[model samples]
Target: MKVHIHVSLKSGVLDPQGRAIHHALEGLGFAGVNDVRAGRLIELDVDDSVTDAQLDEMCRKLLANMVIENYRIEKVGEKENA
Candidate 1:
């Protein structure tokens, strides 16, 4: 089984890195970008025995910082997961 994890900062939390990127884009003449948020993607390969609950647990335990980040799980094709 192939699982995809997207981890990102929660709203209202400070994101200095994202703000820096937004500023850099404006410096490079990129306009109309109101905001920017940075996040992470994690891909996992596992046996069919892995359940959605287990995947969520993995996110909570290590993949994402539960205090300020949220995570979403998705299933992807074998080729994409690879």
Candidate 2:
């Protein structure tokens, strides 16, 4: 199974990398970008037997920082991103 973990900082958290990207965009003359928030995508190829509960645990335990980050788990069909 293919899984995508979308990890992002919680609201109100400071994102220096996102800010840098936003500034760079403006410097490149890409206007009208009011704000920018950045996040990460983690793609995993796990066995079919990996249950949803286990995946959730993986995110909670190690993939995301519960204190400052939020994560969404998406299960995708093999053909979807291929």
Local distance difference test, per candidate?
Answer: 0.92, 0.93
Please write out the lDDT profile of model 1 over residues 6-32, one tens digit for every residue: 999999999999999999999999989
Expressed as tens digits, the lDDT of each residue in 1-82 for candidate 2 is 8999999999999999899999999999999998888988889999999999999999999999999999999999597877
The TM-score obtained by model 1 is 0.91
TM-score of predicted structure 2: 0.94
lDDT for 57 (candidate 1): 90
| C-alpha lDDT of residue 18 in model 2 | 91
